[model samples]
Target: MTDTVLVTYGTTNGSTAEIAESVAEVLRKAGLTVESLPARSAPGAARYDAVVVGGGLYAGRWHKDARRFVRRNRVLLADRPVWFFSSGPLDASAAERDIPPVRGVQRAMKRLGVRDHVTFGGCLVDGAKGWVAGMILRSGKGGDFRDFDAIEAWAQGVADALTPAREKRH
Candidate 1:
C-alpha cells in the first residue's frame, strides 16, 4: 500500500497554507498519497502513515491552531514520521540561513520526535488581517518572501526519507 501523508498548516495570511500545498504536491509527485488540510480542520494524525505540520510564526510563536493540533495529536504523531515547518520571516533571512524553530516548536519537536523541521520565508501582502499586518504593509515591509524552490527541495527530502519505509511496508 502506498504511504498516506497529511500535509497540514496554520496560516494567518494564507502563505503557510500555500507552503503546505506545495509540500503536498511534491509528496504526491513522489508517489505518495497526500492530503492537505488546515490544521484547525484536519483530522487526527492516527489516520496517516506520515504527517507534515506547518504554521506561521507570530511574535516568535507558532500559530495557535498549529500548536493546538500538535498538542491534540501528540500521542499519535509520536509513532509516525512527522515533519514540522514554520513560515514567518518577512525578510530573506530564512532563505539565506537556517532559522531555528521558536522555543515552543522546539519543545514540541523534542516531545514528538519529529523527523525534521524547517523555517521558510513568510508572505504578508496587502489586505492581510490585523492592525500589525496593516502597519507592516503601510511601512513597506510586507511582501511575498516565500522561496518556493527551497520549500519544494525540503519536501523532496521528506519524500526521500519516507520512501524507504514505504517500500519496506509493501
Candidate 2:
C-alpha cells in the first residue's frame, strides 16, 4: 500500500504555508500520496502514514496553531514517523547553516520522537500583518529570504527517507 503523508503548517503571513506546499509537491513527485493543509484546518494525523509539521517562528516560539496540533495529536504522532520544520529567520543564515529548533519545539520533538527538523529562511514582504512586521519593513529589513533550492533539497531528503519504507511496505 502506498503511504499517505500529511504536510501541515501554521503561518501568520502565509510564507510557511508555501514552504509546506513545496514539501508536499516533492513528496508527490516521489510517488507518495500527500496532502498539505494549514494546521488550523488540517485533520487529525491518525490517517496519515507519516507527517511533516511546520510552523513560522515568532518571538522564539513556534506558531500557536502548530503547537496545538501536535498537542492534540500527540499519541498518533508519537507512533508514526514525523518530521518538523520552522521558517522565520529573515536572513540567509538558515540556508547557510543548520539552525536548531527553539526550546519549545525542541522539547516537543523530544517528546514526540520526531525524526528530523529543518529551519528554512523566512519571507516578510510588504503588507505583512502586525506592527512588528511593519517596523521591520520600515527599517528596510523585510524581504523574501526563503531559499527554494535549500527547501527542495531538504524535502528531497525527507522523500528519500520515506521511499525506502514505502517500498518495503509494498
Candidate 3:
C-alpha cells in the first residue's frame, strides 16, 4: 500500500507555503501520496501515514496558527511520525546560525516526538511585509535565500526512513 504524507505550513508572505509544496513534491517523487495544505485548513492528522509541519518565523516565533495546530493535535501527533521545519533567516549567513524553534511550542513538539526540525533560509520581497519587517529587510538582508537542494535532500531522508516501514508492511 502507498503511504500518505501530509505537508502543512503557515506562511506570512507565501514563502513557507512554497517550501511546503517543494517538500510535498519531493515526497511524491519518492512514491508517497502527498497532500499539501495550509495549517488553518488541514483536515486533521488521523489519516496520514506521516506529517510534516512548517511555518514562517516572525519576531522569533512561528506563525500562531501553526503552533496552535500542533498543540491542539498533540496527542495524535505523538502517536505518529512527524517532522517540523521553520523557515526564516533572510540571508545565507543567517542560515548558519541554527536558531531553535520558538520556545512556547517546544513542549508540544517534544511531547509529539518530532522526528526532526529544520530551519531553512527565507525570502524577503520588497514591500511584501509590514513596516517592521520592511525595516528588517532594509538592514541589508533581503533576497531569496532558500536552498531547494537542501530541502530536497531532507525530504529524501524522510522518505528513506519511511521506506523501511513500507517494505516491512509488504
Off by over 4 Å in 3: 94-97
* Per-residue accuracy of model 2 over 3-101 as CA lDDT, tens digit each: 999999999999999999999999999999999999999999989999999999998999999999999999999999999999999988998899999
The better candidate by TM-score, 2 or 3, is: 2
List residue ranges in candidate 2 displaced over 4 A.
Answer: none
| Clashing residue pairs for model 3 | none
lDDT of 1 by residue, 27-94 (tens): 99999999999999999988899999999998899999999999999999999999999999999999
The C-alpha local distance difference test score for the whole of candidate 2 amounts to 0.94
Candidate 1: list runs displaced more than 4 Å: none
**lDDT tens per residue, model 3, 42-115:** 97888888899998888888987688778777778888899998888887853566667777557667788898
Clashes of each: 0, 0, 0
lDDT of the candidates, in the order given:
0.94, 0.94, 0.84
Q: How many backbone clashes does candidate 1 have?
A: 0
